[model samples]
Target chain A: MTTFETSVPAIEPTGSLSDSVKIHGLLAEFETPGDILKAAEQVRQAGYRWWDCCTPFPVHGLDRAMGIKPTILPIMVFFAGLTGLIAAFVLQAFTNSSGMSVWAMVWVTGYPYLISGKPLLSIPAFIPVIFELTILFAALTSVFGMLTMNGLPRLNHPLLGNDRFRRATDDRFYIVIEARDPKFFRTRTEAFLESLGAVAVEEVQD
Target chain B: MSSIRADQVGGRIVDNTTEVPGTRAPLVLNMTTFGQVTAQVAKVSEAGRAPLAWYVAFAGSLGLLGLLGVCVLYLIFTGVGVWGLNTPVAWAYDITNFVFWVGIGHAGTLISAILFLFRQKWRTGINRFAEAMTIFAVMCAGIFPGIHVGRVWVVYWLFPLPNQMEMWPQFRSPLLWDVFAVGTYFTVSLLFWYTGLIPDLATLRDRAKGRLQQVAYGLFALGWRGSNRHWHRYERAYLLLAALSTPLVLSVHSVVSFDFAVSQLPGWHTTIFPPYFVAGAIFSGFAMVVTLAVPAREMFGLKNLITLRHLDNMNKVILVTGSMVGYAYSMEFFIAWYSGALYEKFAFVNRAFGQYWWAYLLMVSCNVITPQLFWFKAIRTSIPLMFFLSLVVNVGMWFERFVIIVSSLANDFLPSSWEFFTPTWVDIGTMAGAFGLFFTLFLLFCRFLPMIAMAEVKMVMPAANAHHDEDGHHHGTPAPATGGPS
Candidate 1:
């Protein structure tokens, strides 16, 4: 199993952090989605795991090229929805229904008021709340799951230090192979990226 | 390869710039390049200051918002009795406006979530504003129920929280269901809107020249670096949210309909209320979208972006849903007579030919008769006519709620209790204030945010990226390479 890195707390430097720190990675700029996909494939074929492609928008087929496995978001969302459905049912049954005996004494004091002569345990009346809660949980799970899975809200990353890297969100694409990768060698990786037709290659510092 | 022809359809010039081979018409007109799409869309947000007309509209909206605040304060100081709540017509304009505004909110979710899932590319042009309108309209809708509780301070009692009184809110009551439905709808819509806005905000953050703008945009951008890995998760989450919201769009209004449908009221109690209400909601929602978009596109100089085709498409939706609403009207009448239920018969009859007959006529003309004009291509595409008809639809929808609530109640079972309900100054002022609140929030949104989704718009354009081959020749077709070098 390939274990993805979770959020790492940034270590505070004693003095002159930029000067003392090792280069974070090499960011190679590509003009088109095709170029980045090609670069990603080369890096993946070379067995470089600590690498990612950045684009302004999603590039179709790029995931296959980069050898990224399908995410398990749907499974997470499904369980969340089920939890909500059960929780809603339990809540309504406890609050609006009757008869939970403890020992010889009737300990349950549920708010079981009769509405329009309808039965206390009305399943039809409970469906709306169940449906809403199911959706609410599923939707919230999808968002927080995505964020958690992606390790987001970090608010800062070493790649952001590269001035040219800002264009990753606007009219540019990049493939960055981190220094932490096992296959990475400074001169060899730089040459490999340039050979792949990178428009510009720059060192991203921590 | 011929581009511009002398032929004109629906008052729009048949220009070659938008034409795609084998297609009769273009999806987007005059969108030649990716840079033009970005520059045109980003300019609205990055232009340092808005146009004079924006300020004028904003000022007017703010004035109305002030009036709304005054009316709300006065109502809170006094009571629900300040308005027109009597014996028979207990729910006059407050609930009418509540249902009306909530109905208007439906179109935004339908456009942003449903149309998106259906792969309707045209929605890219208007979904941002539509979603924003949904949030604001729901805000307006929430105020009515909040204030309608009579004792505003104890409004929290509506929730099922543990209280000192050892009481829980009645779960079976549709009104309680409404609190959950609307509250959940508002929360989810807000999350969906903000999620969509992140990438666009990042684009704006990259383009911001000033310190304050950069900081503000950057904070909201949430440190987005557009990593394909993040995009992968973002896309999945977005798709799931859309799927979740589709059911919510139906469920929210169905639950709202339940507030009436679950009751034994003559016109209100029917199985058909859910679908009928959903249809009417989308109908009025589309009309409101048109009413806002037509002026917004003109004021923001976004003609090339939000072109006549968008307006024509929305008008088509209005026609379909309006017809559905009309069909519901006829169905109710037919079922009432066919069922031989005297009270239901009286409810339908009293709505049309009774004292509130003029309200019924206005509803029919504005909703049913007026939308019938869209059968003409000229009427569908005409900006002025469409704008006027959109407002007419708004008025018609309001009166539809009025007729359903007032007419049904004012002539219930007992003749002695039947009395006409009339609105005082407070009711009118408060209702007008809701509009003020909507426009006020909208105008602020127009000024601050990227009113159009820049990234999504670029995705739809043909020349979004410049592709070049090894020989340095520009390739018009997508690269045949499915994967990187094997």
Candidate 2:
């Protein structure tokens, strides 16, 4: 209550855990994937939503830890492929049949173009290009959509600022209980993380 | 049901049988390193001196290719009258070779694209070489058509343009379609093959000892990094290309088939050509794959990568397609009998029991009969037998085309127009030269290119099987499962 006490950076009482609590903006390292997963599960169970997992390689069930759903890439690729099929079919048919003025000349020339009594606009004939277009479109969608969804071409990140995060390219795994999570209290979250087998717990600063 | 042990100890079936003196339970090498991996692969070589044989075969092929060059020169100087190609039979050997080469290219795409889509993992071992064969074979196939037009200089006329001449390639013509189909196929297959090579090129670049090697590989690699993001994009692109290629493969051959089928030529005017040609294409392609792979496995020490298992799988494909081709043969005969059309009946009869009956029988024996042996596992698994069978398949496939082209053209409805067409020295030389061209390029590709995809192979290692193996390990834990904080 005194002016000197306010200037002295407000020392907290030892009895009150909340008043004595300290928050560190850094993620703790995990010695094994199991340790990281345990922490992630505890955080998830406690109803903390804002969290992420980073690893050297894609770790199985990491998506579950981060509460991430399956990607819409397959759907996007399917549609893109469908578009390709349509484009190829239409283009080939038009060019082969109606688009060219050669039909009129052939009719007049009387060159006897008949073969096995098959019609001009054959479905079997067009199948090849149609199939080709489907693949072309789907593949393009997969490549482009994957890039766009990942928010790639990013030259910098908050994780890039940390030296410890560099080990994400090696044998390290990380589970960050984000500040935005509702259950992320400064002291309680750290204590909870320590209890869930995290080797060290620190807050990640943005 | 087929247990060797007669007695049991406790609850477990146990045998107190002595190990056979000669058979020490077949010591399977625990492949732990790349060097050991190479050693295991080397052991798969049925012939230790095969690499030396490869050098001799390559040298011989190169010589033949050179002889083909001389023949082409002779033809260029002497004009169209060098040998045969008189009047109605003008297209003979040139067209046959063209069709043959184009058919050869089909196997590459069928092996690479369709097989890739089906998740046939065995394809990974042979697809690379098959693709290389496709490209080279196509190159050989393309040359005949280019030069056969007489004025090889004016081949650009195939390309549609609003030029000073103000003419267009006949859009209605199947030949024009052949140009489009073949051109598109070659371009797309080239891109598909190159895209797959980029990552492998990067691997080679890292391993290169010389400055030139590094620069060459680096250029081809396009600065590929194994970043997961890059891999994600690359894999998607590759899948798309493979998808594109499946249709492209079919179209290329169908277009080639149309060259014969769309016309009112007696033997060629059938609706079954597309499927028939596709089956034949795959049949021959598998044969070529076997031909190249059997030798390549022995020479490049890729037996493990291109295992007996892979060969067995390819042999199965060959058998299925070969049967389809054989079915086509039977159908052609049935259609001839069923249609009651004099020309169709004559064409079919002429093809089988006609003047070129030997050619027809050769085709049947090679394409139809030999592939049937694949039904037996022992025959399919035998390296020497499969090699011989592959060669037979290739020869039969060639004869099939020969019978189709020569027999039909040699004796058509009008006897005056029908002439027995024989290949000239030039024709024989050029075809032989194309083999030379294929081998020269292939030999270089083998020496230079990272023939095996090391990165891809590495990705398939036990370490990469972590997820799948976990399910396996739940039943058998040799060590305390490392499933906790270390």
Candidate 3:
């Protein structure tokens, strides 16, 4: 079979890379959000770009402590909502007022009917659908934009496999600094995390 | 069995206003650590077997849901004539049920969106449950309109789409506005609910012992690592959604009102309909929230989180909204008389003394008179009385829609075509079946997911406000309280 012929050569390259299991990151567990809040400020000052703190809930001032920039999501959502509003108006205006025909499978012509002597292009009447579309677009963007920015729906994360670090979602707070960060040296960073009073620090495997 | 879980409060834990002699009670009772919050909520979902009551309730709900399924099939196969719809009363039970269920969905959004904007930290306890109720109630509401169309397969025609018929949905029509409004509402509510669930799902995913449980929870959890970067954007998105939803909550019911108000029918053609309908929606929605919450918190041993304060607060909302609804009812009659229009006067007068007088009487007595009982602190806090009153309010609300829709349609201007409307067995069964669908979804949500928003709850506790530098916890000794539930 063609499958058997291609498989023999592909295994050789993967076998060479198997022995050196590269480190994904290091996790430093904190007993309290307060503890992590203090350490995050230190880490932020140290200029480690590839690090993130983890908590069970949204911690007040932790973003500032970590020097995280305020998200631009609201600005984007506003524009997305605006697009919905304009699109609704255009769609309604063209279909109900203009003698426009658009092709989808076939040319579908706009058919406007006189009902209760109401005008065909009534903006007042069209407002509800416009308003609803605005909301629909903004809401969809908010959820999807948040997910996209977070790089979520990731099937695996290195720290999820770590036992003690699993408490990040339960009660404990964690700070993980990736090994790929420029300032990251295994010993020095571990010592720095320990000195900042991490209750426990563990290396995470990729 | 009492207000406090007596066994859990070992003097160190503050259970209530009366728990400790010198201190005021905390919002969360008999708890000192974040771990305790996680454990309390997780235990409910992680239980090997649900309590006896769960099985009993689920069986009853599932049975009714089956009734709904059968009724839908029968209606589709046999046609829409299975219901008691006559020529004049064509919009009788179906439209009434649609409005009733849609109105009941309002309270959930009000709590989740409006309360969040107001910075009501106490909403943390019950917002998730209320939002779940909103989604399910909307689902139930959606069914009525979809089936009432008679031709189930052609429901897609409601949307503005390119078709061989060469037609577009009339955007100018309030009915078409309703399709978009309700559809958008369902989509937004689902997104908001799912957004709230991700972190909690991660919590469930982490704690799951069985392989199947782990995989199922993990997949939905989307491999959430509780990263603060994610939470930062997540929180921003939540705020944006809440802000978007606030006006949306108001708009949905208002558009529903437009469905009637845009018409020229005497009783239905009123400018006051939007606010009146929205108030009634909140009234009935709050009542339904209590109707579900009282049993749910008790059944799941979640009394400490969803405490008497939460119930007391919800009853307060019911009382305010109920009084508003009563005022609106009286105002309608006044406006009718003030206008001096013959048909309007007859519509209001006939609504009171017509064939549907019994329905009007039940609405007034239950909605107007029952919520007045919540004025007493003892009554508001009393579990059994509030529970009973909530059910009455729900019944009163359902009848309110029935009277409004049927009475007006029954005695229209073309009096020769008018007729007294009555529900057939199918009509009654389908309405009851909607409740079955609602409860079936809710019971499953409670069983499989974190019924309480544990993450949000922990955000509100006093411990979250601690500043390590100021508190001198800087050297960071492992606080014994920070460990997992002991």
Could you estimate the TM-score for every candidate? 0.91, 0.71, 0.93
lDDT (10s digit) by residue, model 1, range B1-486: 222221223235533234357653544466554456666777888887899999998888988899889988888999989998899999999999999999999999999899999999789889999999999999999999999888999999998666556567888889988988998899889888888888888878777789898889988888788887788888889899999999999999889999888889898988899999999999999999999999998998887678787888899999999999999999999999998999989889988999999999999999889988988888988889999999999999999999988998899999989999989989999999999999999998988898988777766654332232243543333333333211
TM-score of chain A of 2: 0.71
Q: How large is the i-RMS for each model, in angstroms? A: 5.8, 10.3, 8.2
Which candidate has the top score in TM-score?
A: 3
Worst 10 residues of 2 chain B by lDDT: B1-10
User: Which candidate number has the best lDDT?
Assistant: 3
lDDT of 3 by residue, A21-132 (tens): 6677778989877788889888877778788898999887777777677788998999999999998888888678647555444566777877889898889988998999
> B33-125, model 2: which lDDT tens digit per residue?
333332343232222343676678778888988887887778777776775676656677788788888888888888789988997655766
The interface RMSD for candidate 2 is 10.3
Instruction: Please rank every candidate by TM-score, starting with the best.
Output: 3, 1, 2
Instruction: State the TM-score of the second chain for every model.
Output: 0.92, 0.87, 0.93
Model 3 spans > 4 angstroms off: A1-19, A101-106, B1-25, B468-486
Task: Report lDDT (Cα) of residue A38, candidate 3.
Answer: 85
After superposition, candidate 2 runs with Cα above 4 Å error: A1-206, B1-30, B33-51, B76-78, B468-486
Give candidates' CA RMSD values in order: 5.5, 10.5, 6.4
The count of backbone overlaps in candidate 1 is: 1
Docking class of 2: incorrect
Worst 10 residues of 1 chain B by lDDT: B1-10
lDDT of 3 by residue, B311-347 (tens): 8889999999999999999999999999999999999
Every candidate's DockQ is 0.33, 0.08, 0.41
